[model samples]
Target: MREVVRAASLLIVLCSAFISSALAAGRILPHAPQIAFVSAFNNSANLYLLDIRHGALRPLTQLPSLQRGPVWSNDGLRLVYESNAGNNNINLFMIDVRGGPSAERQLTYFSFDEVEALFMPNRGQTPEGFVFTTVRGPNGDIFMLDVPPVGENNRPEL
Candidate 1:
């Protein structure tokens, strides 16, 4: 009877510690906006969108590879990221946030890795696209890519 009581007490203490640590890590507020982040599972990293207000999580990518550095366009309609798919060279890919994984389009096919992508603002008479750094040697090179129109999946001209 004493052993049973001790086991129950240990279980309760463990549960309490877990809950305390989770709370200390910070909770998503009920009114918080949605956010996109990457999480790794089973040796693969994928993108996910969290609806903070409702605490709903939706995966944005299901590829069996590493995807990271997601950045939103100025209008928030699309996201560009880097993925090490097809030969393990991290290249840029874009997807319409509302269209899910089926709308993902490859944006770069360079031999080296392209990362740190960000959308350039389209001010009055300015062209809009994303700029990224290509990792080759000790120092990487920055390149700008023009975004094609929606529904066009062809690779953008350099």
Candidate 2:
């Protein structure tokens, strides 16, 4: 009976260890997805992900310039931010928070110089999307960048 009890305790311990390791391995850079507001306008403002698993900071943009005024996607899977670099163009860019390569391949082009961006959900049968604000003289106008749903299995779809 003592041997049997010892064997059961050993089995439980091994199972617990295996479960812990499995959970650890499954945790990638982000155990939970995060988006941050950065100071890229003057002091190297860029979006950063607080990777809980790696315990490190990850920048969303690959650009060598400054970025700011980030707007996260409706589903919280992606972000679109503004970058100026003291140039005439203030381009919009999108990146994934999960820290892999950005699924969308192109940077959004705006004819007007942009200053900030935001995303609003279409909660009442409106099909959610995003909005961006760009400076036109002293006034800034907010515009929409409509996008299709990620579709089907929707694992935190963005």
Candidate 3:
């Protein structure tokens, strides 16, 4: 039964190819999530992601301005931080880790200085927005802004 043997071998080869392609396409399994952080690099501060499993570091933000106080969302999908890029005051910004550096969005349009921002999780433990201290005139007050989660098409409203 040489024909029967050849047919079985061909079937096995096609199955193996399909399985290999599916795995390589990232459809069968996905990469583990990583942690994001901010650090000084090349004389300027920027954001970086740390792959804790393999100790690999990936640069997420490569701006010339100072990026600091990065706080990850409750779901670990986005980051909110303060940046002084092209502004006289430090303002809050949000960036998606999956969308790369161009995905950075300015959340605050005011001239006030915002600092120490952090994501506040809701009762269900999902990130609602961020709370930070802003300096208005001679006093600093804590402010909150509710924003849509990252990757959504909606723009954040103050």
Per-candidate clashes, comma-separated: 0, 2, 0
Best by TM-score: 1
Q: What TM-score does model 2 achieve against the real structure?
A: 0.56
- Prediction RMSDs, each to the true structure: 10.4, 13.6, 14.7
Top model number, lDDT? 1
* Global lDDT scores for all candidate models: 0.69, 0.53, 0.67
Model 2 has an lDDT value of 0.53
lDDT at position 151, candidate 2 = 34
For residues 1-158, write the lDDT of model 1, one tens digit per residue.
67445544544553465453231111122233555666666667787765544546677888898888788777666678889877789989887768744678888887788888978877844446778888897878888888877666666544
Order of candidate numbers by TM-score, starting with the best: 1, 3, 2
lDDT of 2 by residue, 2-112 (tens): 744554454455346545323110111222433254523233545555443333556565455766666666656776667764465886766666665434333455556
In Å, residue 82's CA in model 2 sits off its true spot by 0.8
Q: CA shift at 16, candidate 1, in angstroms?
A: 14
TM-score of each: 0.73, 0.56, 0.68
* Higher-scoring candidate on lDDT, 2 or 3: 3
Where is the poorest 10-residue window by lDDT in model 3? 21-30
- lDDT tens digits, residue span 4-103, model 3: 4554454455346545323110111023435455555466777777554454557777899988777776656667888998887998888877775457
